[model samples]
Target: MSLQGEPAHVLIVCTGNVCRSPFIERVLAALLPTDAGVVVSSAGTGALVGRPMEPLAAAQTERYAGSPAGFAARQLVPGIVDSADLVLTATRRHRGEVASLHPRALSYAFTLGDFADLVSGVTPEDVAAFGESGAEGARPRIRALVRAVAARRGLNPPLEASQVDIVDPFRGDETRFEAMAQQVMGVLPTVARALVP
Candidate 1:
């Protein structure tokens, strides 16, 4: 899909737009080619608009890659949902919240992990081909293998289901924030490839 006149827009969602989502947005922007013609932004389904990222998250993010200078948090609104070509949320609950607010987004909305799956075209048959016994057992095996490869290459593994949710790390310590950030960052390049390629 050529992001020509229409820039591919991605909106990352979380609880307060102060932690996971913002970190994902910055990492995506940095990982993607500057001329890739994709516009990346983030919001919180229930955010404290005009606020900065949580102090701990900000500190951790900065420690790894310098401060997210001038970054300001924003609340998720219908307009943001409507404008996004892709909507990635932190969890299944967050996906539901966004969908309830913008039912029109149901098709485009997915957990970041799930979107990764869509891009890779990993179907049930593919899972079965692994011959890992039952479907349930096979799916995780496939996902883990893919995730391992992605991690090695700094890419996002394809998601197995849109329902596969990322755990939120709100009100947690810097360690938690770092863990969440690492997960989000891992998947961002995959998202970027999907949007730009």
Candidate 2:
């Protein structure tokens, strides 16, 4: 419960760690707070373990940000899933896979885009109010917003269940990957704020 001192460990999941997951890992690592003591890592359910990221993904990552340098594909291990304080996946199916592996780990796995949905509900008014109140009140406000969005969309909240699935980009061309990356990047700020702040 106390993520203090001990780094807030996050594990990102994808079908192959060589692509989207690594991309996300790098992006989050670059953007998320370093002083918050959070560590971001990535893995794949069926990854090649020691393989390097896909060439296109690696190239795009360099162009986007230089954080994922020398990243090699890693297979999703039970211990990793169990140990992480947060687990994010690239697809709904990947969330399910993680859940099945560690049912107790359900609270952590969430789609990158779904977190955006939660953030969308936080209006400028809410942000201003939160700034005045402080971080404790801000957290409850964020949780409330997540619930409101989930109810309106009739989607189960990922915080309560391992259901939010991000769009998959496997085998897709550069264009599709770019689109997916955009979607993921859009939510990074929100996630960083929530997890680190």
Quantify all predictions' global Cα lDDT against the true fold: 0.68, 0.68
Off by over 4 Å in 1: 1-3, 60-67, 122-163
lDDT of 1 by residue, 1-197 (tens): 22344355778898889888887777677766666666678999888889887787777666556357678889898999998767888887888999999998776677787666555554334434533344232223433333332333224544444336655678877678777777766665676664443
| lDDT for 122 (candidate 1) | 43
Q: In candidate 2, where is summed lDDT lowest over 10 consecutive residues?
A: 130-139
Deviation of model 1 at 121, angstroms: 2.2
Clashes of 2: 0
lDDT of 2 by residue, 48-161 (tens): 788887777776677666465678888898999987766777777788899988897665566666655565555545444534243333334434333343343444344432
Output the TM-score of candidate 1: 0.72
Residue 14, candidate 1: Cα error in Å is 0.6
Candidate 1 has its poorest 10 consecutive residues by lDDT at 145-154
lDDT score, candidate 1: 0.68
TM per candidate comes to 0.72, 0.73
